[model samples]
Target: MISIGHSPDADDLFMYYAIVFGWVGDDLEEKFENQALDIETLNIATIQGIYDVSAISFGAYPFVRENFALLQTGVSFGDGYGPKLIRKKTTQLKKNFRVALSGVHTTNAIIFRLAYPEARIVYKNFLEIESAVISGEVDAGVLIHESILNFDTSLEVEREIWDIWCEKAQEELPLPLGGMALRRSIPLNKAINIESTLTKAVEVAVKNKKILSKMLIERGVIRVDEKELDIYLDLYANKDSISLNDLQKKGINKLFELGFKAGIYDVLLECEDYFIPTGYQALRNS
Candidate 1:
């Protein structure tokens, strides 16, 4: 049995897996009997599974590299809709602003620091970020995940950090959204099989819009409109092809450089080991 962990944002992959793996039927029993896949929410604590894939962020990369082995690469989701630096319209920002993040050690926080070195960042769960921004607890908020879609309109978008990275790099950098990975102990064939299955699953999901939409709603993780989600899934999913050369590596490298410039990562070489290039030159060139 293989155990895969990923963030809530990666629910699309899970939905695709269910569709392609024959794991969903009129009832749950038939689904489970037909498919031998298991999935769970990824966290820092669950890094030791025999076969593990994670939606690694900046903070998680250090942990994954220190613990797991590199495996096949996956598609890039592109720089996320750009993390929103939101502030209450009434708030004054004469001084360096205070910001709230999902976690201080998360990729969002690192990107925030790289984009605004002088700002103060604090940790809060997703629920608290918008409230903090609106109630004056924080002058600005760095929002990710579904929070990007659910953000209150009253708050103003001061800047998009990923846009800054794009400007600096002069290319559309992949935001290192997430990928499939395996534990060092897994048999190489098993890992390859899992990758192949997942890639095909994604393709199936893309073709079956009804199943994909139902999966998203059932999961309750996506707050965006169905049209938007459809567009996103179509753009990001191409299961027949797997490439690591896109924005994921380049965007990550850019982020690493920014992290070094901002003094967020103490050892740059350590960060370098976290990126494993998958051999798809088209993705690299794109």
Candidate 2:
């Protein structure tokens, strides 16, 4: 059995549930089981090599490349928008202002650090960030996940992480936020097969979007209700999330370059070097 792990957020669930629901078909040589955790927890578990496959932050990928290889499918990227930095009304932020981050290793946090190197940072669960800011626990907090949509009215967006990405990325690349990773020790054939299966799962989910959304809501598999979940899924689990394209690959490489330059990584590495090999299937078919 292969253990797959992903965040409990609606986007992650939406991308993976077709396989969970048996809609991907039962023609697998390996059995699959899934577990859900918060993104931070999943990233930490990735350090331990806990799952055969797991959803990991792009920021954390640089550190774990030896243990996990990037999977092209099941990714989340942002075009014109992404996580928001917010604070209670009229609270001006200074360069040295303290901020609450989802986690030190999240993609948003990575950009936030590079953008505001002097800002004092404290890590908190994504859910508690708004209250922490409102209670004056910190000068600001970076809101991620579904919180970017319909946040507390009292708070205001200071700026978006996407804006930072645009300034840093000269290329017209979307910001790579999260994607699935496979354990490097797995056989190349099995790893490639799993990646293909996941790509199909995402395609099926997007093709049958309404039905899956209703089922997810009815089964309480996601946090948001119908309308909000619909918006969230469209933002993160759309056609682009089905597989990595050339731009998506460049986006990830950009992230690695930035992280390495900022001293977050010990070495720079290419994203393509770690992806599961796909040429084997073509070779056999030929």
Best lDDT among the predictions, by candidate number: 2
lDDT of 1 at 60: 42
lDDT of 1 by residue, 1-286 (tens): 3455544453345334553346433222212112222222243433544335554454445445656644334443444464677888777665468888776555656666666778777878756789998888888887665566556878988877667657655677666544455565545444445555655555556566566666666766565667666655554454422545544655666766666666766656333354333333336458
TM-score of predicted structure 1: 0.73
RMSD of 1: 6.5
What is residue 21's positional error in candidate 1, in angstroms? 6.1
Model 2 over residues 1-286: C-alpha lDDT tens digits?
A: 9999999888999989999899994888997899999898888889889999999998898878998988999999998889999988879999999899988779999989989999999998888899999989998999888988877878999988999888887666889999988999998888888999999999999999999999998898788878899889889999999989998899999999998999999999889998888998789779
**lDDT (0-100) at residue 177 of candidate 1?**
44
Q: How well does each candidate superpose onto the true structure, as a TM-score?
A: 0.73, 0.97
lDDT of each: 0.56, 0.90
Weakest 10 consecutive residues, lDDT, candidate 1?
A: 29-38
Candidate 2 Cα lDDT to native: 0.90
